[model samples]
Target chain A: MTERAVCVIGTGLIGGSLMRTAGKAGRTVWGTSDSPDTAEEARADGFDVTTDTDAALRRAAEDDALVVLAVPLPALPGVLRRVDAVAPTCRLTDTVSVKVAVADHVARYAPSARFVGGHPMAGTAESGWAAGQAGLFTGAAWVVAADDGLDLDVWADVAELAWACGARVVPAAADEHDLAVARVSHLPHLLAAVLAAVGAAGEDDLPLALAASSFADGTRVAGTRPELVLAMCEGNRDALLGAVDDALGRLGAMRGALASTGGLAATVNAGYAGRQRWAAARDPEAVRVRRSRLALPALREVGRRGDAVVGWTE
Target chain B: MTERAVCVIGTGLIGGSLMRTAGKAGRTVWGTSDSPDTAEEARADGFDVTTDTDAALRRAAEDDALVVLAVPLPALPGVLRRVDAVAPTCRLTDTVSVKVAVADHVARYAPSARFVGGHPMAGTAESGWAAGQAGLFTGAAWVVAADDGLDLDVWADVAELAWACGARVVPAAADEHDLAVARVSHLPHLLAAVLAAVGAAGEDDLPLALAASSFADGTRVAGTRPELVLAMCEGNRDALLGAVDDALGRLGAMRGALASTGGLAATVNAGYAGRQRWAAARDPEAVRVRRSRLALPALREVGRRGDAVVGWTE
Candidate 1:
């Protein structure tokens, strides 16, 4: 593996995870954090940590290093300004959840730096300097967005970093990355929050106590850092909105099917069909294999019990 | 602890969990299954198990034991019919997910038997004879529904079983139980199944492979027994439909908020407010303490920064 110096700014979950992985991969890794305590903690944990943003940026500027902006979305503009002031010639990348806004901000403020908007679709609810794990991005998807003007070699280096962290690489436009995440990630978070709220509603401890695994799983993301979720939602508002709308439309149809007096069997069948259709559309091959292995047998068993108690029409 | 004999019919997850807990609590537990292998397995696991429903029912009839119908909803009618013929005098109860349907069936088919409908809102995705755990119902909620004409002692016994198994007891009408489960349990299952279906539709392997804890948690129940879910949906169509509708309406509103020019800040604010409201409604004491905790400076660091950005509104 070709050796590359990597400067990870922010020293948060994403930044810390990357540092740990890169250091393990034998890459020269340096990190910076605003909090001196966090910087000291990272250093104690074996990361070459620093508190000076300019010093970190200057190091990247002096070497052929990859500079990753792993800060929160709201903090991006300020961080980008600092990067531009100190490391105008360094190759830049980011691990922001929402890409379009940050891409726009970079284009406006730090146009001189060779930039690629990226998002590693992986994380836990835990955050900050101490929560970083070496394998956090293992088997995760790394969304990379680059324009035609960027050097192919620089793109490959960033892509290599993603691969080193055990992430599969996917090429997406900044807008597409933002939109897809809004649907797959952000909307789910909001839905979980809403569901949690619903479960928590009323003085009925029975319902809350009765909340089983489904409740726990459904609301897991709702319990995440409320501010961070809020920022992601705010940053990728249009896309998240579209996703929420699409989800609502689908949910409404399901509700309507259930409400109809045409029998519960039919409604369940419709739900099953809709789910199958959506899954097929999202990933046909995996769905085909999984449906065969797990879901098909169960469906067949239900079918064999009796002839078409409920069926779906295209 | 009283040493009363309890017959658990259909030795699957729910039934086996009950038997394990009852046995540990000093109850003489007897179990029956249609398959001789399962019966033998349950018996080998220390319960007095039998394949012959008649023999089990006769034994319960002779002993005046509590007969728990822990079979699928569709199988309930057939089981009730058999129990009617063999154990007509035994105190009857059930662990069905949907109560209204079972209650109605019992009322019509075995009107003479002292019957109560029950649902223990606790389980794992794993099922069958092997998946039963003694602590399965621990810290969970048990819903009990009985008519005024039934024996109070039997009701107390069932409630005691729930407590002995480490579950909190909650009383509701059969209809109420069905409605509440529809909202808190059934709808979430549908959502998970749908979301899984959506992820399964992705063309690339990355999304499915990269599906982290959030995706796994969100879709856990969707990966459950399709037959069981279909049965629950069919059995509690009206209530599930109503809950799905409520969820859809809320999702739509969220989507609309996101799509608006102001974007996600408003939607997030609403979600935060909704969660707070829900928490307050469900457990005022917990919510009060949470609010107080949120007010503390140490916790404020982790509190949502977006609320300030979104600002307070009506």
Candidate 2:
């Protein structure tokens, strides 16, 4: 097989960060953005970015390079259709936060191409081309999955992409990925928004001046681009709704037991113990799979629980 | 007024930090703790601490000192009654997390001595004597108030105590302070606990592994001492319930608007705008009065918004 370069579509935060990371790794990288201004800004920031998606796809078709599908959920099916029509030989993966819906769409529409799903669990309240930094994924979880039969070599290439961005590749099933993020990411976004709205709910309520450190940190993600928050919350609506229900049920029980000081204290102490264990067990810096940033992986363990090796299974 | 020594009752996080800071400022200080082990820890950390409450009160009465009532809410009324019986000559201030309820209790129970209320907005998830640091209040707000009339000399001593710990004195009304903290501080605690409980609710629920940067920040305060959270929540139950109801209402609206992309986006955008305005307008570092940290205040402004000056009106 001829050498394939890395091609990234959609120069937003994840795509832009990958482009910069790949460029820094001395790989031939290309990127494209939806907005003309963003495309120009990416170009000015030393990226090979273009506004024309078709032209970029044609180039990738000629090169047979690996394509990174890093667009919003609503735009994914159409983008995959365009890619399948143009670059059938390209093995592709994505940075979509959810995996199941897109994996199903890819399996049906792009049956000729090898594609896996990925989500790098590092993001900030900032968005767009300007907000994307090369170091954004440093010590971040890059969750990857390929439910369909893809060549082991192609999966290795996707893992390489994660390493290029200073990320640790943790492979998991698509359903598992969706369920985990709904509780951890999506639920927190809506909760933050709820708290922010509560602060200003009434003219006489909660003067923002008294919003101390706890309040600021608690609602940090509510300040992210609203369009992105809405897209994400709506994209994983089912899992998010379930998580919300779980949280509401827990809160309802707390309300009932509030008068009993011992009961509330027990829950609070349990949470503290759980958090301490999480901090020790889930250190991102320790999640790497021993493959150096510049080297390819040996693909030893296809499925396991991210224990100093790539955690994935059939 | 005669030279007043600093006497901090309850050598916990706030009180311990104040004692350390006052010691650094070359002031003589005494501390009392409810727990024998905690008193031993404070003394080990170079504090003049004891477990005998009555002896500490007698010392404060003889020294003609400013007593800092830094006990938990459930213990505050009883502590104050002891003060009224034993040390009525001492001018007192408190570091209680909530203000209005304690102020009411003070008026009803200890009308003989002049008393002021205080709350230092700086806190961490960690608690107890070991968690205290001299720099805890270096750039924090020390909120003070007295619903009843206070002697200007005693109020100055209290303000001096705040500056000794490198905090800006921000005087606010007790009712206004409770309302503000109810929305910002208290509601966030319940929400954090609810989310933590939700994390481990169902058998197949969120793995703490997926609790990434956002989730961790959103629930940081949940890991704080449960007893402290219980006292603050129960002490300000009425205000907290109102804030929770407001938050639940906003969340209910979001749940309805989840089907409509534009509607959800608008609420998120409004929250972003509000947070931005808060960051710009509500900078704590810039909220200090022009009086030098070591100088006595001109008492320039007492009844305005908390925009770089004290916001208390007679």
**Chain B TM-scores of the candidates:** 0.84, 0.88
Each model's iRMS: 8.8, 3.2
Candidate 1 structure quality by residue, lDDT tens digits, A1-314: 35678999999889999999988988899989999999999988877999999999999999969999998888888888888899986899999888889888888778888887778878887889889899998766676664545555565667678878877555555665565576567767877776776655434444554566787678778767778887777888777666666566656666665666524343334445534443443332211112112232332222122111111122
lDDT of 2 by residue, A266-292 (tens): 556666665565566465324344322
Model 2: per-residue Cα lDDT over B1-314, one tens digit each: 23369889987788888899888987889989889999888878778899887888899899888899988988888888888888976888998989888887887777777787888888888778888899998867777763445566666678777777887776666776787788888888878777766665544322465567878987888878788988887787667667766776666666666644424665677667656655664654244443223222223223224543432222
Q: What is the Å distance of residue A78 in model 1 from its true position?
A: 2.6
**What DockQ does each prediction reach against the true complex?**
0.20, 0.40
The global C-alpha lDDT for each of the candidates, from Candidate 1 onward, is 0.70, 0.72
i-RMSD of model 2 (Å, 1 decimal): 3.2
Give the TM-score (vs. native) of candidate 1: 0.81
Q: In terms of docking quality, how is candidate 1 classified?
A: incorrect
- Clashes (N, CA, C under 3 Å) per candidate: 7, 4
Tens-place lDDT per residue, model 1, B181-207, is 776788788777566645444443333
Q: Candidate 2 overall Cα lDDT vs. reference? A: 0.72
